[model samples]
Target: MRWNAEFMSPSGRVPFIKCGAFVVSELEPIVQFAANKGVTLCSRLSTEEKAEMRAYMSLITNVLVNAELYISWLDEETFNAVTKVRNSSVYPWPLGWLQTRAKRNAVAKRLKALNWHDKTLDQVLADVEQCCNSLSQRLGDRDYFFGTPTELDALVFGHVFTIITTRLPCRKLAETVKQNKSLVALAQRVDEQYFKRP
Candidate 1:
């Protein structure tokens, strides 16, 4: 198989997954892969649970992640203070500025298409709070979304941790999770469980 593509891209892609010559690309298939392998990722997903996971992923992708992007790249204070500082640390000027502008524009256009452009920061924060509350209600002090660690937990934790810990200048969105002790604990738990560096 000719895999002639960037191994990764700014679009958040891993070119392929090679598991002993078998390959899957993209996230959903990776979920399917775990199900096929009887792995914990999707092993216990009932029909309803699968549906719920997909729905939550959709909301997270469109709403939670979008809000983070908006707050990070579009908000001037956040962009200049936190986003630019961190991005410029890893990416040189002009390139960093150019890429940040591009990504910010892309996210802005997407949010505009979703009619989120007109939304006030308070409105955005409200949406984030709603999302956190919903997840908390579903999670309810559990170790994971389904009461056990699964790919869904990993997926949500990835975004939440990044958003919360990045120290966004505005801090409203980050505070949404911190204000919710359960959400904060969930991200912390996922980190301790899966991302230990020792």
Candidate 2:
């Protein structure tokens, strides 16, 4: 909810990181920046597997991210209940209301540009299902997507875990993720290893 930080970001978004004087925003650029600094998680993966990883990552971004925007901003129930409150929490008075409205409008326009604005809730859910299906199939019985934790795994965990855990008015999104056992297991593994302490 760092509203001012988001505005300060070069990309005008959250999830930006600063390493000393270098600042990187967005996931792919962050990953690339790390790689340039001799830090990489996919070093052991073969070239073809890396390509597949990128494909799956693209799928998650195109499908799951759009669905999230749809649910968070365009879904009236969720906007009125959750997003508005959380996004506007940093401000007071009419400023909070105005900022939230402007943010929602921007999201609506972006969704429309991406052709995701018109999808029904069910359609958006279906897109999420398909994305999860691809991820599950790729993961198979592996602990991660490529026998090791890659960026794809991190990306998947970020989105899937949030969907399942966040308190949404519509439970269908979480339910869809839970339906995929493999994906659920992946999320559980990531959560336990990275998020939970012994």
Q: What lDDT is obtained when candidate 1 is compared to the true structure?
A: 0.76
Per-residue alpha-carbon lDDT of model 2 for 104-147, expressed as tens digits? 99999999999999999999988889888878987889888888
Q: What lDDT tens digits, residue by residue, belong to model 1 across residues 109-183? A: 988998888888889899988988887888887888887777678778887898777755586787887777887
Worst 10 residues of 1 by lDDT: 2-11
- Looking at model 2, report the run of 10 residues with the lowest lDDT sum: 1-10
The residue ranges of model 2 lying beyond 4 angstroms of the native Cα positions read: 1-3
In model 1, the runs with Cα more than 4 Å from the true position are 1-7, 10-26, 33-40, 88-93
Q: How far in Å is the alpha carbon of 167 misplaced in model 2?
A: 0.8
What would the TM-scores of all predictions be? Answer: 0.80, 0.96
> What lDDT score belongs to each candidate, Candidate 1 first?
0.76, 0.91
* Model 1 alpha-carbon miss at residue 66, Å: 0.6
What does candidate 1 score on TM?
Answer: 0.80
